[model samples]
Target: MIQVVLLGSGNVATHLYQAFQKTSEVEVIQVFTRNQSLDFPSTIQVHSYNQLIPADVYIISVTDLAIAEVSKSIPFENQLVVHTSGTSALDVLDTKNRRGVFYPLQTFSKVKKVDFSEIPLCLETEFEEDYAIIEKMALSISKVVQSVSSDQRKALHVAAVFSCNFVNHLYQIGSEICEENNIPFSILFPLIKETAAKIETLTPIEAQTGPAIRRDEKTISKHLDFLQDKNQKEIYQLLTQSIQNVKKL
Candidate 1:
């Protein structure tokens, strides 16, 4: 079994620990956390930052800003330490230990149960030998494992923000608009699902539809005028222009 020590008690760490527990090929030796919000199996050990025990791999699933500080706190040197960050570079981990990144390309929530087999695991390590070890651990739970560099991972992270976070915010705006019109936001559920489903087979450019792509200025103007919120109007205009520009290119 691949013995592992987990740091941080956030969504990612908690989900990872849960997944690892279900898999027979990997074992979470200990979890180091300042907050005790998560409930782990009775067999697993939980320690504070300074009381970490020796393990084959130390997975730091902390925030990007805390990664360096957390890595420096580890009492051991030359041990394999990896962080679960998409934006931070691999070098952010203290050089006193072998550094790597084990970024899962999905937004995690404590309440949501993640299917490890579907989630893409992005792995990078300083030493080639370490890659094999990390890969083995990642593959134990996830089927999609790829070697992604720090720069490439950062780009992927930005794209994810655009596709996931930003798109979700747009949904919130749409819901607000629906609410103002006394329309049930649930009425748009099918449309939202179809929009997402289309991208599965069609390129986003090919899946593009509606007034913005068609350059229906009258309809676009109507939407802008209908939106009483200045911010919503601005966003509509900006997105319409952006769509038109992309078509031109």
Candidate 2:
């Protein structure tokens, strides 16, 4: 079994801990978190760095800003230490130990349980020899894995923000528009699902539709006029121009 020590108690850490529990190939020997109150068993949870025990791998699933501080706190050296960040470079970990990244390319939420096997695990290590250990640990919990460089991972993270975070914000705007028009937000579910499904077979550019794609100025103007929210009008105009610009490319 691959002995693992997980650090942090946030969504990523909690979900990783849960996923590791289900697999027989990996075991979480301990969890180090400053938070005194957590759902994890008290027996295996440590509040201080000094209490951290020996493990084959230590995974730091903290925020990007906190990653460096956490890595610096690890008392032991030369152990395989990995962080679960998509945007952060591998060098962010303290040089006192072997550094690596085990970034899962998915948004995590404590309330919504995710299927671990479906999430893509992006692995990177400063030392080639440490790669195999993280890869093994990743494979134990996920069916999809990729060896991603820090640069490639950084680019992927930006694309994800555009694809996921920005798209979700657009959905929120759509929901508000629907609510204002006395339309049920649930009515848009099928459209939303179909838009997502199309991208599987068609490129986003190919899947594009609407007045913006058609360059229908009249319809675009109508939308801008109908939107009372200044922010919504700005967003609509910006996206319309973006779509048209992409077409020109």
Please list the C-alpha lDDT of all candidates, in the order they appear.
0.90, 0.93
What's the TM-score of each model vs. the native? 0.96, 0.97
Compare the candidates by lDDT and give the number of the best one: 2
Q: 66 in model 1: Cα distance from truth in Å? A: 0.4
Best-performing candidate as measured by TM-score: 2
lDDT of 1 by residue, 135-234 (tens): 9999999999999999999999999999999999999999998899899999999999999999999999999999988888899888877888999888
Model 2 residue 236 lDDT score? 93
Report the C-alpha lDDT of model 2 over 1-249, residue by residue, as the tens digit: 999999999999999999999999899999988876465888899989999989999999989999999999999989999999999999999999999999999998898999999999999998888898888888999999999999999999999999999999999999999999999999999999999999999999999999998999999999899999999999999999999999742
Residue 155 Cα positional deviation in candidate 1, in Å, after optimal superposition = 0.5
TM-score between candidate 2 and the true structure: 0.97
